[model samples]
Target: AMHPMRSEHIRAAVKRARGNRKEIVNKIEESLTHCLAREGLEGEVLGREKHIYGIYQKMRGKRRAFNEIMDVYGFRIIVDKVDTCYRVLGAVHNLYKPLPGRFKDYIAIPKANGYQSLHTTLFGMHGVPIEIQIRTREMEEMANNGIAAHWLYKSNEEDQPKGTHARARQWVKGVLEMQQRAGNSLEFIESVKIDLFPDEVYVFTPKGRIMELPKGSTAVDFAYAVHTDVGNTCIACRINRRLAPLSEPLQSGATVEIVSAPGARPNPAWLNFVVTGKARTHIRHALKLQRRSESISLGERLLNKVLGGFDSHIDKLSPERVQAVLAEYRQSALEDLLEDIGLGNRMAYVVARRLLSESGEELPSPEGPLAIRGTEGLVLSYAKCCTPIPGDPIVGHLSAGKGMVVHLDTCRNIGEVRHNPEKCIQLSWAKDVVGEFNVELRIELEHQRGLIALLAGSVNAADGNIEKISMDERDGRISVVQLVVSVHDRVHLARVIKKLRAIKGVVHISRVRA
Candidate 1:
């Protein structure tokens, strides 16, 4: 009753359509060329048949239906200046009935990648949609080749002319800034991808300098565009001399002024509304630095308190002992080690003990068990094989330079490192432990709709939070789900498991230790 088109037939159909579009392009180019000659405009007119794959990719990327793609047939008109571009647009509109709302003026507001042009779509022969682009010579070069166009031309000394590549240079500088501020290479790549598509709006400063930002950019983004320091200290803004919210989306031709305060700092909530990569990256970096500074201060206080317990002060330690501790932790300087300790990546007690041992001072015995003050930050790690919670009896193993690893007293992995008694330390939970701990569960269930929802609801009902979830469907009716949930302590976690077991279709559930 039905037949599917073969790949060869599909290719043939595409080729035929391309040929028809090319014919229409030729007709439009001829009309444009004649019209320009009559208008005494000095310009070059060119027509192109877009690649079939390019057209298909664009349609798919934009989620457009087949009949909705209008740029399959394209033309370009390159003139001498911005005014000439407008004149050419006028002539083209007069020649063909331009489609309403299909015109865009990129010349006034260049894209993030520095592309500038005037784009218009028109109804050509047989009602086929034809797309046209008008630009100045420099804009045409950038529109076609982007940043590479700048390097294509050189001055007398084989050097780039000053101000000739200003926009492209600014774009590259922004990319570099983003790379420096990004958390990682993957994040930098994501920021670059966000910057690549430039649906932009042009706004103005009080000085009348035009600034181009991504569509949906807020006053905060505009502040960052003006200067990083301005962004860091921005407290309020005024749009067109009227007080506006910092999160207000900017529109074309609006004059924006940033109000600053010395005490103002970036709020994490701003990340939710910022559209520019520069703003996001800078905000993340500033927050990271701020957190590090706070952690360093906390670590200094913690180290001082711990050293006081040993009757030895951090400042009184010998230079050689301090250098030995620094070398052991691969720290270039004492401040770095302290910052790491403050961030909870390094244990202050561990470093202090090492400093005492190196200085030939008597090391303190394991007189009393250490209390876990959830404030230990990054220096403490719970053993994956044990998943120790606050209520569990835990033992700390001081690994070479990796800091303390806490394990449940009954964990099997404890036996592997038990011979080194010197590395083991007794630990107890504090009266006011502050944060949550992670525990994993493996759930087996009969495949049914809404089972995941029920499982999640059970945990939520029991005051547990799911951190991560993964599912594996085996046969037609069987499935296994793995979940990592945060709990207050062993008692809270056990209650969560009990509630999960009560859900229908749950065949089995057990805590995954390793």
Candidate 2:
């Protein structure tokens, strides 16, 4: 009482309060337990940095005022077992009513960093919020030191690296794998972008091993996480023991199994559906490799046709001359030059002209149309608008960076450019175009029971697959059906149309071209 109101007196007071910190903690715990017991709680409140710096950081981070900050007697509940942790949580709630939607059970779905605890905020005495966390002692140590705790653990416990320690080690391993597998820095950055998602879902493999993925991740992401090879060859998936689409978004607790085929490869369309960086990068890399091989092949064919006009062939061109041309084009090899021509990034005509410039040959363009086998991989794609099949008259549009896109010669989209030799080329289907091409059909029919079954049966009878189907009711008596049928060629399409025309109550049917 006689002390002066100076800096020395304030410092002394602060020192004395610091000495009483443990006593204050004991009293707080005692009062907390007493309050919970009074409220009929069966367990004790087991266990925090609302101290100056932590409080300041929170204020800066959340833009919350100092008064809005919550405290739990500046400590969390620490128990010896997971079961006791729940009991303590019940006691805490019995003492203070909980804030709605403020509880998080992270033990079921751990955070991306492998942190697991039960967290909640309660309306404490005086209506202040008390944020509480309940965890075991091991979790407390892991939460405090993170992965560093792996190293900090005493050597005597080296064999107990099964729980938090193993998880942290696994996280390190995953990071290293991601870094090593990235094609470049930008690819690495793209691959890791999914990790930035704050929410994650936990699913199980068919083998019962738990896997964590970003929320909204699909079966494709899960497959890639299993292994790159499994992803590359995966054709279908089973989610929770039922056949599911590869694009189906996975849910927590589901067991996912990938169905792989021996020779299946990644589809460029997969890039449209996949969410993870690893799947995207791997798909792109595989497509790039596939495109290179296809481009080199197509490029060689184009160059040889031009060379044929000059009474020369690629095989006959001297190695030195080829190297000189490669240097002129700044291409490392003949394949590189061909790949450029194939991809349409560099004009085939220009490269052909340069190759024969030394011969002073005035050559007319090569005569025959380029043949399409329908298996040109990623470098060649058929136009969706025209839906050109094997029997349709087609022309190739050399789309830069996208290789070739084949369109019907009569397609309105390419009418102006059909005769432009540089960008468009005459193209014809080979004797055997190997794959099915999608053709849209519009059918008007009297609405009747089992109409869908009849149409499906007809298409199946004609050996056609309906890729998609939709119907619109016109007047409640009539309906218009749109079908996307996949067939081998125009003849095959005609057969399918004939089958549809035979169905009862069919009004009119026609192909849809756009």
Candidate 3:
């Protein structure tokens, strides 16, 4: 009777009858107490009438007027264990007509935040929907205590029976990690939101190990949810005895089996496809490792490519000369320098120039399109260094027998050539972008495992593929991971990034500057 909307309407009707506000309030209070007493709620039944402003907010969200709202009161029932929670659910069902499809058993799977309950909606005396939640006594206490339950329940919480707590520390640990990687209040809120009210889908592994993930999750997400290493190596997955795509969306009560591949790495594009935090986080981690590997590979190629032009081969470049150069650059060895170059933190041209000078070769003129005789458009061409592409403005460079190296006019490699009047030459795509073109992306995320696989899935979903990825650990817990992917066009890139940022752990997503 004291529910805000109902109470207001009742009081207003009473006022129209020339009844006093003070008398109306008193009468309402007496009626509530009398009803509770009749229900055998003899202990202190503390109640606070909802304020007008509170009711106003609720009405606004619900899009209802004061008179349309019901004055139903809510109560919490606390019991002993998993069994008792269902028992209480039965009791509520017996008392009221249980609303079809409004029942959920979260007690078995639990939420990402360790929230466990059996929730049911029922139609009471009137047709109003009343929500009832039943859980163990300890769940009741934890719900009341909230974050404080981490300390109260401790690490052994899940081990206790009945009234004891469940292992809340594991979820707390995830929260703490997110808190660190979370960039701001909004991002932190989003991360917490995933945990606060996660709808779960339960699946079983081939070994009968049960895994629970967020609703609308996929087979890839389930694979990662089982373990980070398992996610990293998951090549293909099977659902209910049928070989399913990794991006296959999962339903409740399905059996999944992950096919493993040794040395398989996560792809950044996966971020564009996965829904759950576990898959997203693991994808990020795997992408980080894959990025490092790609960086190393690209760096080595650049080093070898630069050295290829030199008259003296790398093996013949004299140990003393190599050692002297390393000492001057303050680097440990050639391998370390190559890794740095691949990482994009070091300049390949500068290092190459230095090595050339050390070999007693005069500095080649930064002129005449670093070209060679008769080596027109058919030679080594950069996939456009600006809008570098197979079908864009290109230029040819003379590089001896290695032939003419073509670059897009807008290529970063050619950006300086326009100012050098002697070197400018118009060029175009020789054939077409015959193979993959590498493009980069920068994504923001909270550090967690398995993020790399989700990113890979995203790329795959967009019809793009990840060639390589690297992460620069930015300060303040946010990571700036770079992905080099093979894409068709800008539209494809945008769609992939949009999907990636929409993922749970992704904070921001954008194209990376080459």
Error of 1 at 44 (Å): 2.0
lDDT agreement of model 2 with the native: 0.79
Per residue, candidate 2 scores C-alpha lDDT tens digits across 1-514 of 3434544544454455555455555665676778656755444354454445455556678798644553334547766778777777887787779989888887665666668799998876666566778888778877888878655354466565666666667666666677776778887777777664436778999888888888888998898888989998999999999999999888888999999998999988888888877678777877777788999998888778677777778898778888888888788878888999899888776777777777787767878888889998878998999788889988989888888899988899988777876788788899977998999999999999998999999999999999999999989799999999999999999999999999989999988886
Compared with the true structure, what per-residue lDDT tens digits does model 1 show for residues 231-336? 9999999999999998999998799999999877787889999988888988889877776666676557656656776777788888887888788889998888
RMSD score of candidate 1 (Å): 9.8
Looking at model 1, the pairs that clash are: 344-378, 344-379, 345-378, 345-379
> Which is the better candidate, 1 or 2, if ranked by TM-score?
2
Task: Give the 10-residue window scoring lowest on summed lDDT in candidate 1.
Answer: 1-10
Q: Per-residue alpha-carbon lDDT of model 3 for 32-86, expressed as tens digits?
A: 3454455543322222343455556567888986544434333345555667566
TM of each candidate vs. truth: 0.65, 0.69, 0.55
- C-alpha RMSD of candidate 3: 16.4
Candidate that beats the other on TM-score, 1 or 3, i.e. the better one: 1
Candidate 3: C-alpha lDDT: 0.61
After superposition on all CA atoms, what RMSD does each candidate show versus the true structure?
9.8, 8.8, 16.4
Which residue window of length 10 is worst by lDDT in model 3? Answer: 368-377
